[model samples]
Target: MSIEIESEDVIRLILQFLKENQLEHTASVLEDETLVTLNTVESRDTFTKDIAQGRWDTVLKQVSHLKIPPRKLMDLYEQVIIELVEMKEHSAARTLLRQTEPMFLLKQHHPERYLRLEHLLSRSLFDPKDAYASGMTRDKRRQIIAQALGSEVAVAPPSRLMTLLEQCAQWQHQQGILSSDADFDVFQTTATVESKEDADALANEIYCTIKFPGKNAYAECSLFSPNGQYFVTGSVDGFIEVWNHSNGKLRKDLNYQAEDNLMAMDESVISLGFNSTSELLVSGSTDGKIAIWKTQSGFCQRRFSPAHSQGVTSVCFNRQGTEVLSGSYDKTVKIHGVRSGKSLKKFTGHASFVNTVLYVKDDTCVLSGGSDGTIKMWDVAEEACLYTINPAMNSSAALAVQSILSVPLITDQVLVCNKSNRLALMTMDGKVTKTFSHGKEKGADFISAAASPHGELIYAIAEDSAVYCFSVASGSLLGETKISDSELVGISSHPLSNIVACNDDQGHVYCISSK
Candidate 1:
């Protein structure tokens, strides 16, 4: 009643179906009008097969002139390479490998896949089936294959110089020490950095030094209002200090502790945020709790625990200020309704502690970065993870990431920080378009970055007690200023040209003009 066709008959049927479906018209266009006809039929076949399998090398070898759409190529490669690798077709894979070096290099960027590819390449190079002459026994062939697959690539670790530099950086940061000279332009300066010092003297002549209380190390700070009327500072001392930016005046200081029953010295405020209208201030603390306060009256409005079992590292209010997003050491990002102080949805995807969370484009989506060295884009409205970007994996040289700050230069792209303090420009879909660094000063870990709404320039703070102005178009440091007695903490840009506001770790805020 049923018939099973042979492989040859199946191929014939496939060809017939393709022809009847008018797929031949598409295939013929490649041969008739396209440059693909320049290559032999065998080469074309191999190339098409490779393209179908994501063997970019084969297709590129037979036809490199044709502009291969990047998205299509990636999709094809993801589909094919994964299938063939799972099938253990090492020889066939090697054929594709020999044609494409960039594709191989890209795969090598992925640590896990790199190891597997190395094993596959090693096996293909010395498999016993192809190693010895004819008449080899099954056991002998199996042994050879095992030997081939077992071989691993030999690579040397980083040298002493690299390790020493890394050690120096960590020691400097932990001790709250800043380097004297900037290796790159647009360097951030500290209170110790005088306009007369080295590069600081060479770059800017007239700059202002923002002096802080220097009483306690400020953990973080944020703009008090969109109009830049005032700024708020939070510290490990469990206090939220507000300062009037119009003139140096202490406006208010708000502090609270869990009821008398709970007392802990480790309850430091870690992050701060403001609503869209800047009428409310939200502070996250080391106690894994969030406190919202009325900015005008300095009254504590609500207290939220939100089920976070670890310290909240970062907090941000959505565009409308109706909801708030918070990232914590518990490896989860939780969204909370502002008015009700109710937990909305908890995004649990990061394998490590999340360092920062940001609302993107009118709160249509949110971007979160973590110690796991990944940036995840979440659709808040849909409650779905749109995509993830691992710039650390693609980078050839970068330290393990310490923090991530997203600066939306435009509505289309989101700029995020990689381990090297480099800005990785990513599309909304999570594809990294480029990696850019400003002020090239080595050891200049970005404490904060703010892009102007017009997308012309960006203002950033370096670990040092300085501020840097960057040209977003050229990815170059435009101008810099040295601020004495202030370790740069946060930065925010005016909607227009380079007018910027910066906050220091010492509870000080200053305004600067780039003109």
Candidate 2:
């Protein structure tokens, strides 16, 4: 059985929420100290009945605070005034027509109706039952009127806090700080944005710069968090650092030191990746060590020591975050379960050092590139090589693949870069569909590359410290911005905004804005 109150109010609903959740002491304190309240309606049933039964006096007394439109109020007045005339209460009907401001406007705008009322008054006769020609009873007419005003007077759903946070999330997404496809927990996360309106499309200039702690530390690899709040960089000096997204400051709090006086791995860091939610981050080192850290606390949650006999070149987590996919100079790719701390499967047959590896086709396949100038697709379940991509066989390029990048939010296509004079977009198989090239007679090869989250633009960093921008659809060069005198070795694009983080071999990470 449900009990009914006169009406719902904020404080009472809050109290009910508190008490229902076993927060009696807090509820008591809230009830005793509460001053804020919702705009309350008393006995909503009786109030609605007064309107539907044509008790205009009662309704008129309560309607002012509802803030219903003046036009609607005028219609209500006309209904009652005509009913009074039908009831032979001419003086009462005339008072509303001439005295009330809304009724006065209605009379001025509709002279013919006013004239009919005057004629009826002159005749001294009318029918109360036939006040409306639509044949609706007076009671039914009032019910219809009440129904029309139902939305205006009815109380809105509670929990203004959630509504406000949801609105904020939506607005931030529209403002381009949060991508239209990404959202955040407003209660726990504040939208930290350094975006400009013009930069929403592409980035051309360096926005800010962050240098590693040591002058000689080179950032070998970099990547952004999924939520776009932070980005992590792997340096040649055996340190993996995380930085704040909106500012170029180091997030020292996320630097977890496993042992006393130790900051990172014993060997130089080579690659890095964030799990789907950014809850965990996995770092691969030059000496074939892999460390998974709790992102929030920066704790070394797990490690796979000597996962490969040589340097771990690239690393990422499966979408479920339960498994890790890694490639190494050992010329092998392997999947390791995070919980069991065991190697699950290994794919072989790359003749040289594997440069990169990633899971594709819904985590059922492994794709890898190698220094031997070939890219191989392997079936994850069967541990068999599906196909290999050798660029020399299909194009006039001098090399195969140095890196393979997945276009964010897009499946079936990935960006491929190599020592060749061209960059191409290829499918999960070995077929190339689009290629990007330049006529600047040069021997500078692309060391690293990243694509826009929506697959609109491509940012490839060359060994000459030049960042080339290319249109994904047209395969045309949009522009190029040189970042440093030193060779830029790595690049990472923001997951949501038009910002790219590129790092040089001399230890500086430049955050460039599309605006």
Candidate 3:
């Protein structure tokens, strides 16, 4: 097999390589032939020449034209003025001080630096080295300006050796030969241990606590938008509330009605899931109805009444969000088209209520976990069970799988929660890789489980109103957070942050953060 490389991409790579290696002539020739002038090269050259030759006026003019950040530009201005002071060009430095925006900004934000520069202008016969306390040489200041401009304009800096090493590491990572968790920070060389530690620490804090509106009914399920800005909760009173998760503001309230009266019991939303892009939300209700809503408008765009014979326990959207999968207490899983609002396919294998459903293997298969102590993988196109997995039985009590989550950043592995206090990380083939148990001391019974955005940690809410954290790599108990006094019902993790949200049976929602 041969790889097809785009001509533009190849040209970009070669030009970048030549420029980094200082082969200016070769890079110029390639640029001319390809008619592709790099976005940063021309501006960088002009800035470099102006700074090196002490062309203060020209440098200021170019700085105004470039899209340099305010802070960086201020630093550049300070360096240039210091250079002028060292050279005893007081008149030139004064002109820059009055004319440049950066100098004025520095005066407003960093008055100390500005006052020092002003004091240097009063010196008549001072040593050049003593003009600025920093003692940064003229050549060093020029280099700093060059690097800042290159970075601001998206130009690759002069570090050919480091660049080559990074390329090798990237290739190794792509080939699965380099473990991402390796000791050496090949990909993130500039990241410090403190930053990583801070990130890991964010997994332990409760940042936001949101209380639902209903006095008697509590949230049964909750889901975060794929972008993590918003979250929706389904309540026992058949009301779905959308919230701005960052600030705990109620965005919309979607109420279900039964002939003008508020619907309860079978109409209660038991499970909710967001589509891949977060544009739509699919909800499964106890009344065997599946509804799709426009996330922005909170309007039910499509509804499938009597989608199942009994309560719909779990609902999920396919990768495209064009289809929805739902598991029901009716003992079956059904797939429905979002546009047509018609049942497209149904799989029947579980001996008990199907609690959770998800798309697997590029959405070609469906994975469902039932109270019958088994998981069944069904072929979407064939409409048949492809395989069944019975996890290792640890007790004589009937095994009722409560929830299933695809392990974040992991392939063919899922986190499964059962009626008992234990959670299992198992492969699609049903092999248990690790088991996390909530010791009897806590008296915590698993209600649901969620994996962190990066799959490094697994979070579970138990009967004791506490959230338990487990390390996915070792299945060790990392920590636990007591979120409420009422029983916790549902939990979800932000897609891109170390934030987790859990709702309790008392209409309270707690947003836990690692920070």
Total clashing pairs in model 3: 5
Give candidate 1's whole-model lDDT. 0.58
Candidate 2's C-alpha runs over 4 A off are 1-200, 252-263, 393-400
Residue 301 of model 2 has an lDDT of: 87
Q: Which of the two, 1 or 2, has more lDDT? A: 2
Local accuracy by lDDT, each model: 0.58, 0.76, 0.76
Per-residue lDDT of candidate 1, residues 301-399 (tens digit): 777874478999888787777787899999999998878889998888888888888887667778888888787888887888888777673556433
Q: Which residue pairs clash within candidate 2?
A: 199-515, 202-514, 203-514
lDDT of 2 by residue, 473-510 (tens): 78899988888998778889987678888888787889
lDDT of model 2 at position 435: 83
Worst 10 residues of 3 by lDDT: 255-264
Model 3 residue runs over 4 Å out of place are 1-202, 252-266
